[model samples]
Target: SIEGYGIHGNSAEWSIGTSASLGCFRLHNKDIQKLFSLVPVGTPVQIVYQTVRGGIDLNNNTAWLEVYPDIYQWSNPELESAKVIQSLGWIYEPHWQALGNLLQAKKPLRVEIPRVIKIEGESLDIDGFYWQQQVYLSQKCLEVLTVNFKTLRADELFSGFVKLDTTDLPGGNSQYFWDPQANTLRIIRLKVLLNGMELSDAASWSSDHRLLMNIKTIAAQLNAKFDWDCVSKAAICNEMKLVGEPRDGVFWVELEGLQRVWPQLKSTWDGKNYTLELMYKKR
Candidate 1:
C-alpha cells in the first residue's frame, strides 16, 4: 500500500532518504542521479507524511545544530584552554603539543561538538561540500598515546592507567626473566636459580607452566585493550623474570595443581623506541 501503489496520477511520493525513501523501491534517473549525488543542499532534507511521520519531528522538538568544517576560525585555538589529556581518537603528537602550549600561553582555543541537531534554535548554512549534508564541527588536537596527569605523583594513578613501569626488566638477568610492561620480547626458559639447582624440578615444573600460559595470554590480550581483565592467577605465576630486553632473553614459571599460564616474548629497548612489553602477575 505505497499510498495506493504507483500509477495514481503521475507521482505522489518523492521520498528520498534523509530518512525514508528506500521503501517502495522504484528509483531511476540514473537512480535519481546517484541519489542526487549523495546529498548536501540545506542537508536536513527530512520529509515524511506518515508511517508515524517517520518518527515525526519537523524541527519542533529542537535538534538541528550546524557549525560545519570552516577550520578557518583559526581552529581549536587551544580547545577550552588545552589540558584535556585524553580523547585519543586521532591527531597525533599530543594535539600538536597541545597547540604548542596554547600558542605559548596566549590562550583561547576552541573545540565544540553537538551534531547537525537542533530545533529550538534553528541555524543552517547548507552547501556543505555540495550537500553531503554537513553535521561536522570537529576540532581535535593534542594526541600521541598521551599520559601525564600534570606530571603525576599525588600517589600516582592515571598516567592513562600506569602500566609501563617495567622496573628495568628484572635487572639484566642470567636467569629469572619474563617481562613486557609494554614490549621487549623476553619470552621463556624456567630455571628457578641454577647456582645450586632446585627450582622444584619436574623438568623445571613442566617447562615453567608452559611459559606461564604464554605470559598469561599476553596479559589477557593487552588487558583486552582496556575493557581490562588481564588474567593469570595460578598454576605458576610465582614470577619468572627478564622483564623484557637485555641482549637476547628468556624467562618461565610454574607451580601446578591445575592452573595454567603461558605466553612469552621479549625485546624492549626504551632508549628511544623498540618496545613490546607484556606482563601478568598474581598469586
Candidate 2:
C-alpha cells in the first residue's frame, strides 16, 4: 500500500548517499538502470541502516573500525563501536579519549586497536598511550619533573585576578589573571628592564577546576610550529601530528611535542618489552 516510494535515479549525484532524500532510496542513473535490468518488477526490496562498519584485513590480521554519522540520531556511536569491537574478540584496547575526539568530528574514522604500553626505567607514576606512531603522556606527569603547574578553583576567581607560579617561559616571567567582568583569562608577560608589559587573553578554567585550551593555542604561546589539516582534522605540533584528548583529570600530549618545552626530556620505544622508556639527559 506504500505508493510513490521506489528506488529512483537522482540527478543530484552528490545527494545519492546522504540523507537528503524524502523517504526514498536514491542511486545514480547508471546504477539504477543496471539494477532494474537484474531484478524483476515484483521483486521485494529491503533497506537497512548501519552506524558502525567493521572489517578485518586478511593479509595482516588487523581489524578496522569505521564509525559513521548517526544520521537518525537514534544510536550512540561510541557504545555501538565498542559493541562491534567486542564482537570481533580483539584483545587490544582503544584510547577512549583519542576515539572521542575523532568521533566528535563526525567524520568516518578508521582506528586501529591500540596496544598496551608501559613506561620503563622511570619511577614516575604516569600512564601513556600510543596511537599512529605517536606516544601521548599524561599532562600532570610533567609536574613530577619539576615543571610548574597551577590549579585554582572557579569560586576563588570571583575577585577576577590571580598570580601564577614562577616558570621558565618567554621573558623569564609571566602572570595569569582572570577578568570576571569580561569572562576571560589574561596573561601578563614581564621582561627585565622593559618599560611596557604585554597582556593577552588566554585559556579559561573548566567547571571541574581544570584549564581548558586547545593544542593550537598552547603551541602559539610556546612559539612552536603547529599546523592543522582541515580535510583530516589532524592537529600537528612541532611538525608531528598528535592524537589525544582530555580524560580523567588531565589531557595527554605527544611526547615529542613535550620535548620542545624541555629539551632534556627523551622518550624511546622498547619494542622487545612493548614499553616506552622516558628519561632525562644532562645538557
Candidate 3:
C-alpha cells in the first residue's frame, strides 16, 4: 500500500494543503500536465518522512534550513538535527573554509564585492578595469585615438576597435577624435605629453573618464620600434618585451607593463594633468 506514491488526480481538492493523501500524492491537473511534459520518465522521486529540508539559493547568496512537525510520526526525532546539519554542509563548507583561512592568517579579512553596472535600468556585465572607480571603454571612444587621428587599421576578424601604424603626423594637435567614418562622436583631450609636446591623438579617456592608451602608440611616438607577434600575442618595442594582447580588434598594453619594459619612462599625474617624461640620447 505504501509503494504507490506516484502523482495522481483526486476528487478531494479541499485537502490539497494537508496530509490527507492515503499513499498517492495528488496534484491539480494543470500542474501535473506541466511536470509530465518537463521531467523524463526515469526521474527519481524521494518521499522522505522527515519534516526538515535544507537548500541554498540558486545565486548562492542565501541559505536556508527549516524544520516542521513530523505529522506522520514516522521520523526519529533523535537524528533529525544531525540530518539537518549534514544537509546544510553543501552550503556551509565553502564559507567555512574561507573564514578559517582568514583566521589562520592572523590578519584582517577584506572582501571586494563587485559592483553591478546598469544603463538606463538595464543590467550589463562589469568587465572593465576598476581602480578608484570603474572604467569601461566604448568602441566609439577607443576609435577616437586610432581612426583619422592616427594611422591605424581595424582588424577585420575582431573589428570592434582599431590598430595603429608607426607613421607620424606633423603640426596636428596632440588630441584624439572619435570618427565613425560616416559620422563623428566627440573629441577627447590628451593627458600625456612627449618631449614637451602634447601627445597628439594617442591617449583618450575611458568610459569611466580614466586615461587609457596603447603602449605601441606611445613607443612609436617616441621613435621606438614596435612590433607585434600575432601568433604569440606579445608586443616587442626596441627589443624590450611588454606583455600585450588584442581585445575587440585593438591591441593594448598596461601602463605599468610599459614601465617595466622601459625603466627610463617617468610619469606624473597631478590630479588634473598627466605627463609622461623620458630622456634618451638622439642618434
lDDT of 3: 0.47
Best-matching candidate per TM-score: 2
Off by over 4 Å in 3: 1-188, 204-211, 247-250, 274-283
Question: What would the TM-score be for candidate 3 when compared with the true structure?
Answer: 0.30
- Give candidate 2 regions above 4 Å deviation: 1-4, 57-62, 109-116, 145-283
Cα lDDT for residue 68, model 2? Answer: 78
For residues 6-109, write the lDDT of model 1, one tens digit per residue: 31211434553223433344454465566666864344444432110011123432111112232235444335222332332222223233233224422222
Candidate 2 residue pairs that clash? none
Q: What overall lDDT, based on C-alpha atoms, would model 2 receive against the true structure?
A: 0.51
Candidate 2: residue 209 Cα off by (Å): 41
lDDT of 3 by residue, 49-72 (tens): 655555655453444444555666
Candidate 1 positional error at 257, Å: 20
Candidates ranked by TM-score, best first?
2, 3, 1
Please tell me which model should have the higher TM-score, number 1 or number 3: 3
Q: Candidate 1: misplaced stretches above 4 Å?
A: 1-145, 151-217, 222-263, 277-283
Note the residue pairs that clash in candidate 3.
Answer: 144-177, 174-200
